[model samples]
Target: MTSPSHHAPGAEHLLTRVGEVLKPALTHYLDLHAHPEVSGAEARTADRFGRRLAAAGCELTHEVGGHGVVGVLRNGDGPRVWLRAELDALPMRERTGLPYASRDDAMHACGHDLHLAAAAGAADLLARLSDRWRGTLLVVGQPAEETLTGAGAMLRDGLYERFGRPDVVLAQHAAPMPSGTVAHAADRVPMAAAGAVLDVVLHGRGGHVATPHLAVDPVVTAAAVVTRLQNVVARETAPADQVTLTVGTVRAGTAANVIPDHAVLGIAVRAAGEASLDRALAAVRRIVRAESAAAGAPREPEVTVASRSAALLCDPHTTGSVRRAHTGLLGPARVLSWPGSMATEDFPLFGDAGAAIHGERGIPLVYWMLGVADPDAWHRTTSDGITSDGAASGAPDAAPPPAPNHSPHFAPHIGSALRPAIAALTVAALDRFAVT
Candidate 1:
């Protein structure tokens, strides 16, 4: 939930000095939120970020990985700290009735719009206060993160070779937590998870519904596959291993009177470790193929792991430094060390204290959670004890709990999330890029 109109902790002077940037950041945020773009198609989004970065005193480079934007600020070059923001939105409809709600089919349900504006605001603040620290601050707007391909695409396109790897990489994600607060998971592996997009297609012979056994029902096979894969995580995986298997969609027949020739299903698999992920995926393949074969499908079913999200690991040193800095700024109460979730993110591709791109390790990654929920909404959920996923934990609930990321109803409290987010990034950079 939104705080009572607060300034960032221990950053009153700097916040005032760079206060002008927040207005433009708000404008940028609204603009981004209102006109969303999908992954790999963020051309205009890249342009918007590029302009903002340039205004923030960053040297801009475009098209690193399809429309990725890189903004570099060199100040006597001590440590190279990289701050990244996602440049893409989801393909969900914007149901929020705010005046600035997106009119397009796409939506910023994940709060990337806020993250982009925050990165811009931080760049502006750092550039204005150039005397505070000495380092090369690299601000990057990464594309295709929703599809879990942006980081890999950027890496393959010389992201490190051309720009050089960072000494420390920092990022943040918008969470359903109370606005004006932040969360970290330093003790546990913060946000380290492997995820994959699984797509399956089953081929079968079609026949009229009147036929008894004339058709090899791929729909039945798909149903069996879906039902069987549910046990991959619960029954197969070790109790300690965290894993999730979700069958998002399944499509098959055209009508109740006719059996379709083929069926398709989309699945998502994620886990904190590679072994858990591997086991789940293996189970998926086994179940899908086995079900299809048993149903006497026309041919071998198509199973694809469309995308594999990189597992992210935060460096203890870098994460600790950020934790300390944020704790000092926002206080220990506002800054919490929360547990990690199964949700996947592409930010992990940056590596943990090393060069994950070039095979040699060099850079460390640290990503924290920024609360964007409206104060009233978050409090309503807390008072009523809402589930972590923003679902009401109790029955007979008045309404579904506060919306979380990816939900069409998600509307971050930009007024409260923006300033603190900017401050958090600015302070994190200042902490790592200490005055030389």
Candidate 2:
């Protein structure tokens, strides 16, 4: 639906229009934020999104790939453009004090509130601007991103098969940066690839705390394994190759007197590319089992990978289009060309099969980054609040986003973050579809 314009005409009119159309979408976005559903389980959320898209004139599909939703709008034939919105929320408690903050443990702390809203807004805007261009417009509301299964699930469930693949694949992330600033890096390394969650179980006999010598302490063995796991990255990976092996969680003995019979360690491995990822995973398991055995534990540690993802390789053409779009919409100075993130994104897998399609046919697939950092208001809101643990330590503010995207407190100025994202999505789709 269209709305009135307030600012002066021209670019301001366009901006105002985008915001106006996005108001309801923003409300929906906030509503989704207040009631976030977790990954592999976005049934209700998916239904809500489907209704909205269907109401907005998108041909809707539900449960496409375990709670995934797809909305297709076919305009006069041109180049096909695909816009992706992640529907899953992280398994984090809402810490943002916004009135619309998520009431559930699953919160849109990753700015996905804005992501999905922008997708909705983009769909609405593109529908309105249908006279401009396009072969087809596909708005994808992918689920289960937290577990990195949604995108892969969509492809497996025939995302491309059911709905022909696009000539250009474009998706924008809402940055927490200053208002009106849009940044894009061309053919730069997109998000780094990641491997499955590694669950390691170390088995040993339990004994009394005072008579520790009498029992095979799994805790001690697990501790040794944790300390030595660092060597997988330090000693095994090449010095030049970027690889990270972190044993983030460990569970063992409950009481000081009794040694537990079993020890468990959870790890996440990040690699610059697939080769390094495979190498690191192999080394990590080998070390875990060896360390357990050497620590006098008769049972070997069991290593298992729960999920995996390939690195995000930015399609050169798509990256170039994003760069030009940013340069055109926001200007050169406002466009910060930084390196891509090491974090993982399932988006890259869409083009991985190398199928005969648009992006496969040589259209560049670009993932644009919206700056969500360096701004004072956003920084303070997202990075300043202290956690319950930090509050106990007498600090009330949270630590700055060690990075963006998965932090529970990573909040963005939605009003400011939304405009550029909408404009970028709208402009990118139009630009690509207008090509060829």
Candidate 3:
């Protein structure tokens, strides 16, 4: 059975014409996949995207924020559509072993490479079909998304002021779903959470291991805190609230014989609600400090909020219109309902219309997931009821599960997904200015 194809009343032929040049766009995606750069250091990646946007004949601006690029193409006067793509690679190495796999230590594990290529392709498509719509096209190449600062950096650097505040914002991310499909979550509630990276240091008195009582053992206190934190969500949080806490790292003494003077914990906390996130973070601080004080620590534990990602909420009007536009481009079968995620994204900063953190306001926004998993692998995982992403179990050898974003083995079937991704994004952008 063939998936239904839908497009604007007059865009079908133009979109088909756009397909003729999509091969180069696919090649560009592969090229980006091969040459990955890490966040805050995407000079080479930025250059490539800038070149592409320039080739598409847009008024281009470079380095609004660190390595962030913006391109504006003005038509007549209509709704200004904003599109965005991430340009950073993860620090991890790629193990996909594809022909175009990255040789650099950094890898495009999160599919920012694909996002860049798709955005480039969408720009190309829209540029080619300029006669069909009248408005301005704004495309952004963002940096440092892994650290959750790129969107904020761009905004703070006068993204909306220099360019124009979008009538509607459209962006997409790569997910572990089957190739040739998309997942969308457009609702009043955030599809993803907002939170911060927590850096905590527990101070203690260093002393001989033989005379443990003489030393205020921070390791013991840290351990106890971790144990108690297990019940933070289980006991302290109300059942109605949504919060998840992950203590990703813990470091202490170097030598076995001597007790360490201090212990460090790297925590990631997120929640769908701002109040929930605040409460969770407060609990984290209280737990660590109280544990240290109870252990007779010489100083209070230090807790710092490193980075905060505002929760993601897709504007209902934008989301609904984009969904129908996507359905018109692809079939209903190719577009699936996306389950809300606990993952945090900096993309929220672009659409902080609801005052997510402090007092930040942004344009209306819509973000969806582009499925990238191999069909068979997706089927296997689905059959096995593997609710977790393939790499989440930390069991690479357990089974040949599909590669999730940010995994070493993660690789998008760029060839298969590129055209549809381009079509979907182009349709969504044009939909904002489309006439009935």
Candidate 4:
């Protein structure tokens, strides 16, 4: 990667403004970290984000979708650029042991809090530097991203029609890499997998433990289905294809002696494309029904898709421009190239994949990865054979890697990460704005 001769226009001023806004941004990040709400229930999160945007001179609108917040700041006449951040958190306990960790079950393990803070900071900078550019800035706080339904929901609620069609939409996700670094997909597809979450119910007859011969055990059938589902990827899918089937939850009888009347299963499937995902989903349904029948089930098994998302494909031209802006602002060393992953996201809905719902097409979308791991901690664990707890390992080469997104131990080093995150988004948006 070659370095740029100079920074993007007003890059130095943007950096200074980022520092000026860092205090309140950090405060917001901490408050959000301490009070996270799960998907479809982000009332507090949305309120805080909307208030911050309004404070930064945006025209705020609440509940575009379920608890979605949209803030628009218009200067003169130019392209409308939307900056998006997630509002929902994961339903998991916090184990990071930080000073401001959440006391409840929900936790911001994926750095949505960081993204929100950065967005707030960027909004403040743009509002403060209105004289430098001319455009409409749309700051969006999206809800239910974890369930992969928020983006579509917002579009169905007329996000584009109500506010205005965006010339470009920008977003970023937190990664486990060293803080202050940003990564963009080299192949144009930042996330290459389409995914679906399914719920399965198996029905059977219940009976006492003594009358085992008369009773049908749905638990046993569920186990058999889970075991057979593994073959869907191993034996059914092509060797070159990428597919994953995870039976995340299984529930049955409460007592060990009693035979369960029915069993419930929560399953997830991911694949490189829609065809592969459909094939795997079909295999799951077939196997579930077959296993239930083989086990003398009382009724046919039921399967339903709870949520689904398409592969995230970023716009090449827009991504290239943002990448150059990032390189110019942070230098080539901190702007890294990313190999696409099997992760799936609903962000594609903002582009062509969701034309059916939003009645719009060719809207460019740009997504990137933002590093949130502490450099010292990451280096100590991966290079010096030290654990995250600051303990020296017996074998340095076998040290465990840094905690990843969704882990209970995941924590971002805010001191060094916040400034860069703010500047990254601000510079990218400024790159699209018409210069004065």
Candidate order (lDDT): 4, 1, 3, 2
Q: lDDT by residue for model 2 over 323-389, one digit each (tens)?
A: 6655666677666654555566777767753342213444456777776443554335444332321
For 1-436, candidate 3 gives per-residue lDDT tens digits of 1111234544444346657658878888888989999989999999999988888888899998899999888877777788999999998888999999999899999889889888988888888778777788999999998888888788777787788667777899888777667777747667778888998999999989999988888899889988888778999899988899988889999899999999999899988888889999889988988888789999989998989877888888668877887776667777787767888888877776334332446467889988777666556543443333222233444445677777899988775667777877788787786442
Candidate number achieving the greatest TM-score relative to the actual structure: 4
Question: What are the Cα lDDT values of the candidates?
Answer: 0.82, 0.72, 0.80, 0.87
Q: Which candidate is the best by lDDT?
A: 4
Q: Tell me the lDDT of model 1 at 163.
A: 88
Listed in order, each prediction's TM-score against the native is: 0.92, 0.86, 0.88, 0.94
Error of 4 at 433 (Å): 1.4
Estimate, for each residue in 1-436, the C-alpha lDDT of model 4 and write its tens digit: 1222223587756667797888989999999999999999999999999989998999999998889999999998888989999999999999999999999999999899999999999999889889877889999999999999999889999999999999899998888777778888765554557899999999989989999889998988999999999999999999988899999999999899899899999999999888999999999999999999999898999999999888888888778888988887777777887766677788889999899999999999889888787777766665453233233353557556668888999999888788989999998888888777
- Higher-TM-score candidate of 2 and 4: 4
lDDT of 1 by residue, 1-436 (tens): 1211122234535445557788999999999999999999999999999999999889999999899999999988587889999999999899989899999889999999999999999999898888767779999999999899898898888888898867888999898877767877755574647889988999999999899398888888888888888888769988988888899889988799998899999899999888778878888999988988899887999999888875677777678878777776777777866577888888877874224565647577889888787767666654464344333455564545667789998999887778888888888887777463
> Mind sharing the TM-score for model 2?
0.86
Clashing pairs in 3: 6-328
